[model samples]
Target: MAKARSASQAASRSKQARKPNSLKSAKTEHARPDESEGTVPLELQQKCLTIFRDALRPSADDVAVLQEVKGHLYNRDFAAAFAKEEYLRVYASRWSPSRALGYVRVLADIQDHLLPDDELARLGQSDQESLEIVCLGGGAGAEVIALGGWWSVVTRSMPKIALQARFVDIAAWNDTVETLHKQCVTAPEISKYASAAAREANRPMLSGDAFSCHFHQQDVLDWPENVVHTVITPTTKLVTLFFTLNELYSASIPKTQHLLSQLTAALPANGFLLVVDSPGSYSTVSINGAERKYPMQWLLDHTLLSDSQQKAGIETAARWEKVVSDESRWFRLPLGLEYPIELENMRYQMHLYRRLATKGDG
Candidate 1:
């Protein structure tokens, strides 16, 4: 009887040793996709593999192509260079295409409210006057494009108005700048904001004869005197401060106030300042009945615009007149689950202000 018991114990030990390591195992032994079997579906596994392949393969190609295309190349060489840069940039940057696409889909959902048919017709008018527009602290160019869409509604129907635009940022991702340039030159819908024909006709004015748009690499606090001289000239009619003041405000409120003072001094009396910023609050929005809290109000309160500036700035007649009493226009963008991780916690508002006339008005 003792010999039989010893043999049985030895067999149990051998069976335990044959089992796989819990920590090293690729899949959990007890977990199941269907909840009945202890295994994942074959289709799910294939889907994961496909995603991994797509991400890894494109990333490898982007690195290779970007390296190969470095330095100046002709227009024909640009396509290949751009393709590689875009692939790497989109993947490498904080905002991914999949995420941006999701936001775009949301915008498309509210297209009628954001951009109505009458607005589109007004944009297509032929007699509209052009404006010299400068975008301050513009990042990634998405805000520029969105605003451009609104400008397009005003320009598409109005061909006489030539929109001469300049974008200034502290630092720009090469891929982002390149993408914006391509969209400006090729994409008709995007070009409609500035009237592509006008841009083609006045190509020299568009990018300072560089065969590129005016994209400057400069810091906002200590902006180059020469660049400021060029932009604040008598011709500049509109200045856009999009999502830039928030960074400054959060870092140092005093510095932001000082910068705003300088900007106010630079603008002509009749010139327009369009400020777009994130709101400040934990407002909840539902998507498919799922509640998500987005810090909408907190973003706005932390922004650079002071109460004084809000009250003193010139106002306009915009749709958001009730909520945005101090400014002419106010707009908000909803937060979605599919929003890029970078923009997930924020909502945006557009503030349009006119420079108040001084005692010795020019």
Candidate 2:
């Protein structure tokens, strides 16, 4: 007889089981459908289960409530230890796939604009190139896996460029990040969402694509401004922050703006910042004794973009673009598992700020 799942596991599985299956069954009409279009893939789920062994154990209602309160009000590294275990468990099984879809969508948009003609062809033809990416508050590393997997899928028919990403968060999640890296770059069987053809045509990217990640367990707010510039090269550099800026801005808008100022100042002429965050009031906290929702636009226009009058600022020549999504589908499968995250009807902002090249920029 098979062993039974604990109450928490059963509950989590039950939640994931509720995912829509109608679209997933139309495989005949879909050849290499985007992974965002349906539900999570089977191989992907099994891989997550295999890699992240930490499972969510049931806790008392009072303890759960206290922990939830603490998470909203306290520092992330100091939050409940048991909750972190549960979080990592949920992250591998749930949040990673959802966010990966979003990343792929935004990436597709960027590719369409940047490389309108033969994007995949260029991906395959380009010699090995390196990029340095810095992701803020990315301890669990869902975003890193997403970027690598998306690159693999995007260049499935071609060769992949080299990528070296640095993740900064309060927790030391390098082990989990490394495990995810292995799955994306070397072990491709588990990361199905990367290549849509993997499910339809049964071809996974080979292990030699060469994507690596580094981890830094430090407070992003306290990070030195020029650190990213110091570590990057002449390659196409990028800075990413997913679902993190809201918290920083909530704590202090000026601090968040300062961070942006430093990052944009240090960005090379071709460098850019990509920020993905939800639009809501639920994640809000008290700022100067007044409860308020996340201020998305003010930060973009004021913090990220400087006034044209300030011609001396590093970001004065930069451009900011924001996209709000109501519904857009990628590839997902009906796996009948509940992983404690709402994967549908995503409502968030995808913001990109690129530094325009200027003369005398070296």
Candidate 3:
């Protein structure tokens, strides 16, 4: 009888724990439909639309506040240089200044593969003989030094070696210079190498003369035409592209091909092009295709490089390999207030191309 009573109590508890069907039916009746069936209040819908419109609009007050803050942090003379559209594009994006800094850190890690100390020593000796080295899309110049430490080392070896270092970018040229200065002052290791470079260049350590780094503020498409004719020589050793290509819109692929052709045309036999970009694993949008994929081999076929350039390029090319082939690295952000849709499957590739030896070459 006691066991029977206990079993009865257990059953009673189970019944109490279960929701009644009548209650479930009531909930179902009140719940909103998955599809809007013109049942939603028009006034409520209009209110939501108004809120969204306001959210989308950039307020002048907010702009003023942001500008004041940036001016304080950077400098008092800082003006809103970028267009409102461009500013919104960058500001609304998930890639904030902090994210950009994180990306820079990742770039630094990858650059480690490029200029191992021994390689720097060898490259230094080569530079002493007047090897022209140019960095394309050199953002902030951090990756340039981090990967091409050989440049600094070579400068130290041959102070009189005429080295032409050109930094190319579309915008933020002054900001890049400021960033380089900040890094030189704040980052001790980078500062040491930079100081050494200045000494080798026969410039004063802390003077503006050390700021001889050339800045080219031009579209990448125009780069080869504008600078290539003037700067490129047969002895040009290295050309680098770091973390800049991914920012390009996918529609610019043809433009990219044109740029590659221009680079190939400019580079002498035995010159090299080193490209580093987000891995293909990152998601990208394509206008016609489902998702964009980085065609690395296509880029390789487009460029000119020698055997040695190809070898050096490959050694520095591993960091971006995973990004080009992996799908996991790519993701889509929300379009305004909409939910994030899966980005069309897109991939990235990093490449190093060497110019082949010319006819009658040794």
Candidate 4:
């Protein structure tokens, strides 16, 4: 009899888990059937490709550097892979577009579901206010491009709210990020010999006032606790991990945990955290002196969903509510898209979580 009762309870819990959240469902119901999922617009995609091409230009040793970068990446030596400008250029040309497309699509799907109506309204009312996005390991500019593309589309129907993107990474991506930012928002620099018509046709996709970005170079784990917390400020509304979390885990699990905890503490209630990473088992750990591979998604779930011993044996309330979860999603490059280097499709896992109320809030 007891076994039967336990089984029945488990079944009930499963059913409840399968049910959709009311708020998310409401947004879905009102959305046009075609709007359920979005593709990165071809024009936006082309604009990003042009920005990358214009910024990076062409190099004679591109093929060689590409091979070297891939080798370093395969061995998990990220610092070495991104040491030189040539390597960074090779990487951006090869991978940035597809990753940007992935971010654009994912953000579009979640935009309507992100903020509570009241908070969104308050933000929209203040012209001086901007939506704050902090991107971890955003050095490559994939998240930057993605956010710019996504913001351009969203402002059409919603209020013309400004956007600020803060990129935190260990690499020396300041120069690259700045170049991309400038090219994305300002008109292209015309040649001295160019005709007036040519200059007139070289405008940027979005106006200079639409989007702003900044880059910080520091390893999150090495930073002091207070200093680490400073990266995420009171106004930070959204935080993103774009192909970044797995690398963090691979580097140092303990430090990554501390960084995550600090980030969690800093987010205001209703603030969102978005994580996207390769769906493969690239993150590894040693089990009893033998190295073993573990899926990145599993480790994240364990850290965020499971209770921690650091709570001093007290059962604390859950800190986050999962807003969107997809184990595997594909973003394919649109046909006829042209770029200097081959761009491959991306298969990523994503999770969006909203911070829950904690102690000290009235």
Candidate 5:
């Protein structure tokens, strides 16, 4: 059984609410630079919250649907929870900004610890002269926004580098994904309900750039090797599973393993794999005749760090260099942050691996 009422559940509870299409409160203050450690720029964070709050206004009926969606997800009923557009809208409005900021924090940490300037610049030197990222289960735009936020900062001196982001999930998230992409790349239209001061403050979170995003609505496990190749290309620099790996494992371990293997094999040397998930034993799997629970981080370590697959008679040539591993990292909400709904600070475990050059490679 999965951990009931995980972080997502906590994120769904709004600390404040108002009539539809309005902020939870009119008071907004600037964030302290020292607080976020500069991972998420204060202005960008405020803009991100504003964009989501303005774009996905939830009505009374939508709030009811949000509660239903939360219950279904808590029960691990993903099919039912994400089956409707209303569910996705309410979910995104309620939770995405905080999750997106969480990813911004994680990506910045990776840059500081794992990737240096020259190495990150090389990501755009592929045949197409572009940087590519694949996000598994990234439908709600957390990964998309994170990439945009991070890229915006890193590419200030290298403005010509283009980014191509692909979001893969079972739900139809194209609309939401595009909406976020647009909001990040362009100045958001000031909401009429916004106060005059807010209208003056509204602007693009990130300056315009050559960023393109595409959403693929398919079961990642069902993606054949050929399909995987199309998505995770040689130009790919990053593949992220932000709070998504456990759900994949719970869906089907064999298939999730297959997908991971495919992704690893498809990535170019020096490409990175980032896995973020809720901590503790939230995933249940059956072994022999009984079901057992294992921590998501442990499972990933066993599969990617150790040669347990070879020991189990499964032949694989995957070689990865562990760059970062943490069992629990906290991303607290920035102080003075205000939104239509209160956002929960995220505590997640993360693993980052760099694909090593295999034998016979140049």
Candidate 6:
């Protein structure tokens, strides 16, 4: 009986050893994808506080500017919304850590469906099929940093997959976004947040090589011509838009259409476009210079996507499909020092869409 039990134990060990790498990696990615890493936990939140104070080192004026912008955004002060580009940079510094968590959570939700296969993991650092991620109007490179953070937590072995991320925005945030993205990858203080989130969840953390990000400054008005050069590849796996559409839509739908059209077309079959925007109108809306109200969903559903689809000639079967729609509370301050809205009321809609994979082998 002793020998039989020992043989059984050996068999069990063999079975465990035979499990696929993807299974282990999948578990790592989901480390409380719905909790600590998803919503900024108090401990990780505290970590952000330290980084902002020591590493990021926001000045008194930066703080004051951030506060004033918040009040203006909350009060619907259009002229003051983006009065100074520096204000936009400061805005990102204040909110990106928490926003990064949010982006990771959403990405984790549909990660399985993101690609046709898990080959990216096995082919570490190979340019042959390096995964490309593009972010439109990404202020201060929040999505890129968040993705790098998520990538580290999921595959802890010095970059099991190669990633080339492109962040496109106006010139104002060019330097700021590039610098911040590099900081998140290199800075020990920023890395602590990922370690803390994993530790808090009692999950194993793997050390991985950092992903690379490139910044492109594009004029929104001229994006139709610019996108040809920026996102000119079929391998682009994902296009992320965070807290940007409302501003773009508010400014000029036709111009926004050109950018969206280019991005939607540039996607590889089976790619994804993630749009995460504040749900309600922080301000009013106007369609064709006629001032009125439009729900955030309606604006995207009827106004924006509809127009882009028609202009881009996107087919019905191959058009964008909504995959995830869920709301989570966001922090006015990632440190959790300030709750811009009550915990329950500070809601952000995380939307995911999968581009149709193929059309009759093209």
| Per-model CA lDDT versus the true structure | 0.39, 0.50, 0.38, 0.69, 0.70, 0.53
**Least accurate stretch of 10 residues (summed lDDT) in model 5?**
1-10
Candidate 4 TM-score versus the reference: 0.81
The predicted structure with the larger lDDT, 2 or 4, is: 4
Better of 1 and 2 by lDDT: 2
Q: Candidate 1 — what's its lDDT? A: 0.39
Best by TM-score: 5
lDDT of 6 at 125: 49
Error of 1 at 27 (Å): 29
lDDT of 1 by residue, 1-362 (tens): 00100111112212322232122123223322222111222322222222222332333334444344332122223224334435335332322222222222223333454336764455446353345667675434443343333343344344344555676755443345455445444412224467656766532112221123366655566655555767666656666665455445444445555656566667676565655443441344456889665443343333323333444476422211112212211221121112112211122444555565555545
- What are the models' TM-scores? 0.46, 0.65, 0.44, 0.81, 0.82, 0.66
Q: What CA RMSD would candidate 4 show?
A: 11.5
- Estimate, for each residue in 84-184, the C-alpha lDDT of model 2 and write its tens digit: 54545444444455455445556655654444456446555668655567777766555665566555554444545566777776555666677666655
Candidate 6 on 257-336: residue-level lDDT in tens? 66666666677667787877665633256667887766556655553245335445654444566777665433232323
Question: 218-283, model 3: which lDDT tens digit per residue?
Answer: 667545476665655566666766444433323255666566666666776656666554454122
Task: For residues 75-146, write the lDDT of model 5, one tens digit per residue.
Answer: 657667777887878877776777777787888888854457776567545445676788887888677777
Q: Clashes in model 6: which pairs?
A: 156-206, 156-207, 158-207, 158-208, 158-209, 159-208, 159-209, 270-357
TM-score of 6: 0.66
lDDT-better candidate, 3 vs 4: 4
TM-score of 1: 0.46
| Ranked by lDDT, top first | 5, 4, 6, 2, 1, 3
In candidate 4, stretches whose alpha carbon ends up further than 4 angstroms from where it belongs are 1-37, 58-61, 115-120, 188-202, 282-294, 308-313
By lDDT, is 2 or 3 better?
2
Ranking of predictions according to TM-score? 5, 4, 6, 2, 1, 3
Superior by TM-score: candidate 2 or candidate 3: 2
Candidate No. with top lDDT: 5
Per-candidate RMSD vs. true structure?
A: 20.2, 8.9, 22.4, 11.5, 5.5, 15.4
Model 6's alpha-carbon lDDT is 0.53
